[model samples]
Target: MAAIDHFWAVIPAGGAGTRLWPLSRSSVPKFLHDLTGGGRTLLQDTRDRLAPLAEDRFVVVTGRPHREAVLGQLPEVAPDLVLAEPAPRDSMAAIGLAAALLERRDPDDAVMGSFPADHVIPDPHGFGEAVRTAVEVARDDWLVTIGIEPTFPSSAFGYVHLGEPVDGHPAARHVQEFVEKPSVAVATDYVATGRYRWNAGMFVVRPTVLLDLLARWHPAFAADLRAIAAAPERLDELWAGLPKIALDHAIAEPAAAAGRVASVPSAFHWEDVGDFDALATLLTGAGSVTVLGDDDLVRPVDASGLVVPAAGRVIAVVGLDDVVVVDTPDALLVTTRARAQDVKQVVEGLKQSGRADLT
Candidate 1:
């Protein structure tokens, strides 16, 4: 009923996506990749999708190294809107810093929304509408989260159990409980019950309310954040003192336990794009791909469920189903689709073996 102006957005784009190795290296995270054929990076798509709300309203929290990449993709964002983290301190620290910085601009009442820059949302209109609704609901002093309706039993994502429906709103419901990544059996049961949603890690709330919740649940962390916020220039020193914890584990889960959180089923089609398989699903249509190897060999293959990111390199996959075949000049990765989730471990192993070139 009310116009949703004065709403602020924080896009956290600092993580190094190691799972999508070769393509998703430390120098280039998944968010910076042009996974979709639309010629825009995930961060660019995210910004474009939310541009209706105004570029000035957007605030991006990223590491210093990623500042140039983020800026290159999002030229519309003002220089100050991009907050560069001195070091990697996790989501809680990033959120706190963004909220504190935003507070200086608009104080307690301004509504702030945080989203992962690497996510893929197919339905942009529905996503925008859901965000507006969440912003409106956040005005009631509740930390509002946009939860994706689970389409399958996914072990890679966290789950949120929906409680009673929020009064006067059919689409919104009170969050009964929060569950971390569950076993396959548990995830299956959760989907069968139809009372759970995938935790998409998108949150909307007022700065003061979030700070209050953090203070109540985590006093020490809150004090540290407050100190950082007071001396914004020394954020690096303060961040070093802050504990490394996700916002969900540190604040959201605890606040939900105290009966102060709400969730709206995100109507938009969403994907976390955590690994190569998931990334491929987002890229390809039905099932087929055209591969060009050396000598300009035009080979049409039936790639029902495969992720191939090698464009200018020579690649030849004869018999591989549900496999991720990534060929690069320096390294190659061949793994079953199911085991694609372990690519991060492979990256770690490469680092341990001093194979920095592979990583």
Candidate 2:
């Protein structure tokens, strides 16, 4: 294995994962759930997958409420590496905090790889190689984002327009533009063109380079983050004033507009697992899920493309195809696989109706 002395990983493990409601709650985020084939929690799998590349230099940036959960899942991670955010301030602040913290350790041209904890990458080896490639590209002082070849017209994900190929690395292309999540038809057009890739939301860049870009592009945010890092005790004060902006909106898109962003085509299979349908796809193709009980036995009876996660609970699905039946102790969710994206609306309705238990 190649030594990754200059490489570090920053995992953002916040977010309630409302899409996976009933099962994923504020107490248990998506990263803590077992939504992968290997049975490892998403956070653990993410850390372990990058172990060969990042070695011991990985930081988990999570909200203060989830500190214990993050630590419990990754006991091997040092206590200092588990940086806790006083509140949720979105990805820009998270990455800024990580860069600020990492700058304190290795200020010199250190490469930091940022990833969300809930994403699933099926091929670890391929993922690591892609990271290595990104690291090399980052050495040139350009922000590098991993772009997944779109297998389908996915409206759930954002897209990156690929410009001309880089002079040296043919696999990586200059980023022409970053498009927000598009409509199904627009996504289909993007897929048909074959010039666009799904934005994986994973990035690699040198700490100094990121700090420089943030300072240049968002000076106020950069100052606030630095102050927050310096005064760790007053994080609450810092977070109170930070804006809720994602890295894509705050950094990547701006950099791309400035012709400073590039992308590497990812070889590994990646899934954001943003909702139940995504999770169902990851949990399928393996062991059969069985829910115990006489009155509520939910098995995949003569049905394909179904997910029954009511383990040990009573669930019975008599005639269902391409359906997701998730039974929780408090609530039950039965929806067609195609309608899984609307699960968030259900959560919203539950919240509006003040049904905390259902959520």
Candidate 3:
């Protein structure tokens, strides 16, 4: 695909991924790892996927601690483009700051797309097509999000309620509303209606328009972001006072209500890799043992799950099904796939017990 003109890819790469503990520590988050056993890290893969469209136009917003690591992984992106926050203020501040910077840097023609650095999009071509469509729609002064076509009733993701199609762009639909994650039964009903798509939080909008929409609801917050962008040094001083909120709550949801949001329905598969179970599903199928590291280090008698031998120690599983065993040098995790989401509790317990190093 050819590079999209005036498109700046904004990457938000600041999450601890507490559910994927031990391997995904605060010092080195999950986005910095190759959880899928792929050659490149998740952050690298994300940059590669956006490179075709961004064409060297990139802005990576990450925490101060991981700034050097992000730069190390994405050496192609200019050092100045990698904005590091002095403190964690959530997605709104991260992406909003990027918007403010781009609005100032390319005020006349900057159109920015916000994509999380941790997501795994296997089909970059389809993703690009969706992004291209989003850029076209965004040029008409509407906030655009690439909505994933849900393959199943997934209770884990939020849903984008689709309304009528845009007048000229039939593939792009007006976003009626954004719904929170629903129960399985409710998700099934949503899928049955065929009027919903998974909200992947992929947004494309003109930098000026994004800040203006933000200004409508959060005047001071928007002003602070632009002020930091203008004076660069005030980032730490104003950043602390910014409301720590997700972009969806801070802008997208309200924008949809005001009839200013549109969505491009996409068929590509998207995976957040939120936990070990998701990682196992992405790596291998059911009824088999999948090793992320050296296969020789894992021996399974009747195991059907994931085993990561990161410590190079021999791990033997016998008569176990749907189990997750991640062996790190400092910590080892053994649990069932059914309880993968609960792994965060273990990290919490370790932190409360003064075992922060293990987490």
- Candidate 2: stretches off by over 4 Å: 286-305
Per-model TM-score on C-alpha atoms: 0.92, 0.93, 0.98
Residues 234-335, candidate 2: write the lDDT tens digits: 778777898898989888998999989989987589888887777767666543442212223545556545444544564546566777777766777878
Model 1, which residues run further than 4 Å from truth? 1-3, 290-311
Model 2 deviation from native, Cα RMSD in Å: 2.6
From the highest lDDT down, the ranking of the candidates is 3, 2, 1
Tell me how far the alpha carbon of residue 358 in candidate 1 is from the true structure, in angstroms, after superposition.
3.8
Candidates 2 and 3 compared: the better one by TM-score is 3
| Candidate 2 TM-score over all chains jointly | 0.93
Each candidate: what lDDT? 0.80, 0.82, 0.94
2 or 3: which has the higher lDDT? Answer: 3
Q: How badly does each model clash, as a count of residue pairs? A: 0, 3, 0
Model 2 local distance difference test score: 0.82
The Cα RMSD in angstroms, rounded to one decimal, for candidate 1 relative to the true structure is 2.7
What TM-score does model 1 achieve against the real structure? Answer: 0.92
